[model samples]
Target chain A: GAGVSQSPRYKVAKRGQDVALRCDPISGHVSLFWYQQALGQGPEFLTYFQNEAQLDKSGLPSDRFFAERPEGSVSTLKIQRTQQEDSAVYLCASSLRWTGGTEAFFGQGTRLTVV
Target chain B: SQQGEEDPQALSIQEGENATMNCSYKTSINNLQWYRQNSGRGLVHLILIRSNEREKHSGRLRVTLDTSKKSSSLLITASRAADTASYFCASPTQGAQKLVFGQGTRLTINP
Candidate 1:
């Protein structure tokens, strides 16, 4: 129970609809990451937040994807005009820092389905 | 683009059997890490072997890194049904900001 937690384990949305997914990282973790995992593929990075500052967002597929960690602890990933291609498991991970060689903790992820 | 490639995309073995997965990467890495995902769940960290380390072990898991060959292998001895999952290898390539992952090897342990 002391691990990363993601809200709304499953989400179903109509095409073009908007949805928001939330993630609560492990307590006191300084770095949080957002990744998208399509069926039969590995997780791809979306955005990374070091505390409240979003340092990298190069992996966001499109402008429709927006993520914020206003308080540096709880983060939200909002997708606008969701497309069928956007239907994938969104995973949230946290670590002590953004540097390599650190073990990261992950949440069970939110499965988003758009039809 | 994927940074690593895992061979034999899937493997199945009986309980108590051994399972092996191999991963190859293109660029030099600071470290290589292995993770496991059960069904549609999140990934759990399994082991990490630095580029300089040739081999390491934890419990029934054994990891070997061959930097010269730019590849790595994971061996699970006496695997159990609980080990059924998709195993991914990730590398933090030099000067890369994020870890790049391989397609993964789906391992099934039949009871």
Candidate 2:
């Protein structure tokens, strides 16, 4: 793909419902990142992946938030028992390498609403 | 938590005027990068300035990094209506790969 792609551009879930968001990063991208952007705020780092290895998950807000990149190409973010506070735009980004100088390409993002 | 804090939470400027936004960070970073978001969607990469470099320019965008003050500024010259967007500055954490972004500055170019 030309750029990172996220599925279900918008999702509305009832409180406590579990929802899964998917991300398809650019082919061969080695570094994948997931971020959560609240209303009127910048994106907050959720997790990071290098190839198939999950090196950082420190930013995951709680045990309800989970993310995985099984094949190193596609990723999924699953939130269990979603709360109203969890409603935000989930963004996916990928870079060719896991370096500070490399540019990251972002997906349009999936807007999740927990009501 | 966000490591960077952008000044001027919002700015409204006339078209053709220059817009400048400043960002200050708490930690030492290897590089600082700027991103723009429209309609609160995906973020577009603007410019990046490494810690060793003092300034960089690309087209109408100019970025400056001051490691001593742990601050950076983004200047958009000859702003247009299309330049209206939220701008954010991101700096790498100790991990180097994970970037921490600031709250961002909402820039509006009134025509």
Candidate 3:
């Protein structure tokens, strides 16, 4: 319960539909990250937040992918007009430090299936 | 380019045997980390080796870093069936950005 928590461990969506995934990071963590992992592949960075500021979103595959951490605590990753390629396990991680060298705490992740 | 690439994409060994996995990165890194993921679960942080550190150990896990080679290796001694899972190596780029991951090595410890 002390670790990161993500909602709706599994989700099914139709192609061309929109979906929103939620992540509640450990309280007071300064760095939050979202990653996309395709089946049998490693997680790819999607975006990052240092508190409420989205410092980098270069990994977002397209404009259809958008993520926000409005209050710097809970974050949402919303995909608009999702396609089959968008199906993957969406992972959320948080670290106490704002830098890269620290170990991050991860959530169970939401496995999204699109058909 | 992928920041971290792991080799021998998969590994299988018997219980009580040792398992070793390798990883290489493309760019300079402040530190390298290893994680393990069980089926349908989140990744669990295994260890972190800084650029300056050559070797570190935690329980049955041993990690060695070769910054000159821009590579690292993870070893699990006296493996157990419970160790069966996917192991990944990740490196952090930029001063304070995020972690880039490798495809990971699927390790199976058969009894």
Candidate 1 lDDT tens digits, A18-99 = 9999999999999999989999998888888999999889999999999999999999999999999999999999997868
- Stretches of candidate 2 off by over 4 Å are none
**For candidate 2, lDDT tens digit of each residue in A1-115?**
7889999999999999999999999999999999999999999999999998998999999999999999999999999999999999999999998787877889999999999
For residues B8-104, could you state the per-residue lDDT of candidate 2 as single tens digits?
A: 8999999999999999999988999999999957999998899899999999999999999999999999999999999999988875569889999
Best of the candidates, lDDT: 2
CAPRI grade, predicted model 2: medium
Question: Model 2 reaches what TM-score against the true structure?
Answer: 0.98
Residue B47 of model 3, lDDT score: 99
**Residue A87, model 1: Cα distance from true site in angstroms:** 0.8
lDDT string, candidate 3, A27-54, tens digits: 9898999999999999999999999999
Once superposed on the true structure, which residue ranges of model 1 sit more than 4 Å away at CA? none
Chain B superposition TM-score per model: 0.97, 0.97, 0.97
Best by DockQ: 3
- Candidate 2, what DockQ? 0.76
